[model samples]
Target: MKITGDQQLIKKMNKTIVLDTIRQRQPLSRADISAAIGLNKATVSSLVSELIDSHLVTEMGPGESSGGRKPTLLHFNRSAGYAVGIDIRVNDLLAVLVDLEGHVLQEKTVPLADFTPEHVLEQIRKTIRQFSKKLPESPYGIVGIGIGVPGLVDDKSRVVSAPNLDWNQVDLYESLASEFGPNLHIDNEANAGAIGEKLYGAGREAQNLIYLSIGIGIGSGIIVGGELYRGTSNFSGEVGHMTVAENGPLCRCGNRGCWETLASEKALLDRAAKLWSDSHLDLEEIIQLARGGEPRAVQLLDEIGARLGVGLANLVNILNPELIVIGNRLSLAGDLLQDAMLRTIENRSLSYHRKKSGVAFANLGIRSTALGAASMPITMFLSEPDPALAQEGSPSAGL
Candidate 1:
């Protein structure tokens, strides 16, 4: 009995070291892991044996021989576990499956109807079930679910306020938990976007970053010191409502002439539709017209970019981040929009901030929010767990 207990302890410790090794450094050889993790070669040999047996790690083909024989490289099996992420938007709900390394495996988009609270919730449930059906066989299938709602979200994932969705006091976490089990997290869309950029997108190495999401409306996610700064009420990055114009048009969030009222894509489209009221022309057509050097479309997009830059300048003044990631539908215009924004920012922002802050378009486009939502489960799981990870090598935490 004593021997068996000691063997068990050794086995668990070895596995922990191996797991830590594999997670921190990918595609390493057993010899490399043993050397890097400071575990005895023999101990690593035994633990890797067990990890391979459990399908957690696998040896790829082979690597070049160093001083000794060529050894097989080990990698975390991409299919070890899967996570589901949901992003709720006005037009659609996006669902995705992600692996441990935040690689999206499969994704689906479901068109939304009226977007009433109950209707949206029902759609979320149906789509989540649908997305989960695509997962491969795994011991810890669907580790958790993360929802990115386009609004102010409390730490609890509650919809503190989302005027676009007309949502308030909506317990997104509770509702999701009731249907999908307790491992559910909710966050505002912009926060999720920032997290996405940090983990899997352009802002991966940026400590102080701002993710400006220009979707139907404008919102931002601020990451300071490598963590999201959601403020006291979890409403820190709602830059859209900042009053650029005291006498601006009415905003849905009950603020008059907010920044978004003048510069958001929705606002621009509303203005464009009225100013150029040719029944045959549509929004995309207008964008195409500008892309083809049409005078009005080009002028309109430029003005929109300028207005957006004004908003960005204020944010740069307050938060001098290392990077500002511009993403969402409008970013699709590429330099056409960015040039105007840059020009305005140069004029409006202080020289120090203008020089320090670098602007990059969000390359992921519509997928930004969806990918952000999809990666949420993995982030939450890897970060602090609700009950804390079980003591080293305990079963209560992940295997």
Candidate 2:
């Protein structure tokens, strides 16, 4: 078959253009939208009407006109629907309910003593039930749920492998689909963290970014051209497992001298135990000690920061992202390690590549993964074609 006019695709694309314009420049008039998107007044008006009918956009009273009549202004209805985001870790779960505009309406952090699929699923269901009861009436209620897991997650939302949790090929979507409907989605925690930063944190202004989640085990989220880059099989950003030393400590991923084994929070804690001779100190205490100018703690941070830089040099040499966000629990170390990290990156990576990449700490803190999960539904909802407009011969037919 040969391609033709395909009016539906054109309309869909135009709809996105109009919707995006309205979202960016709220209280815009039809004329303003027309000028912004280079679409005619009639086309803009038609799309606006459709959006209004769909409860996505609203008409405000009026705005000052160029000369003649006052123009009615348009606004994106952020409360048109709600989305749920869940970030699952080995010992904790963070769940958030967000409106269409990515504002957290309600959130909860629950401690988890169990990692069994049944236990985790039950907790998720209960949390969703609790959150759903509090949601305000809207055109779409709980539109979708997104989960960020700290391990290998497939395109279909299955937990392919989470060695930390000892999970293997757990079909998370299948387990929850019957109770939650088909809106549930899942991704690797680092990928979700990257999304969270892209949407709400330090990476907001960056088109190309790398989110280094320096947690118990290290992981990464790669963003390219403002989109999450999940390479074939969704295993693109496992930079933590990248070898940094020819012969060093073994990593849980069955690798020797992996970056995470030297620079991750787990590695820091383990090393701290040997030097400090205090086995009971948590990461926070160590970070606090470092903040207060403890010599050993400070030295530990320098070592970890240097290791972080070594891995980052490799990333800089390869991707040269505009921004590299250091995130996750280890981010709490703050300036204790940042200077050393930057210095190492400066010394290691090639001059030109190093110049192109800027490093920053994640501003969203622990909320990154959960918030990123919530953002998925909003992005999907905006880009998805309306079912009512899904004609048999449409480009998005049966989708």
Against the true structure, whose TM-score is highest?
A: 2
Model 2, residue 88: distance off in Å is 0.9
What TM-score would candidate 2 get against the native?
A: 0.93
Clashes of 2: 0
In terms of lDDT, the poorest run of 10 residues in model 1 is: 390-399
Model 1 agreement with the true structure over 105-172: per-residue lDDT tens digits: 78888898688888888887776666666657775667677788888887777787888888878987
TM-score of each: 0.86, 0.93
lDDT of 2: 0.86
- In candidate 1 the C-alpha lDDT for residue 141 amounts to 69
Off by over 4 Å in 1: 1-21, 34-54, 278-283, 380-399
> Relative to the unseen true structure, what is the Cα RMSD of model 1?
4.9
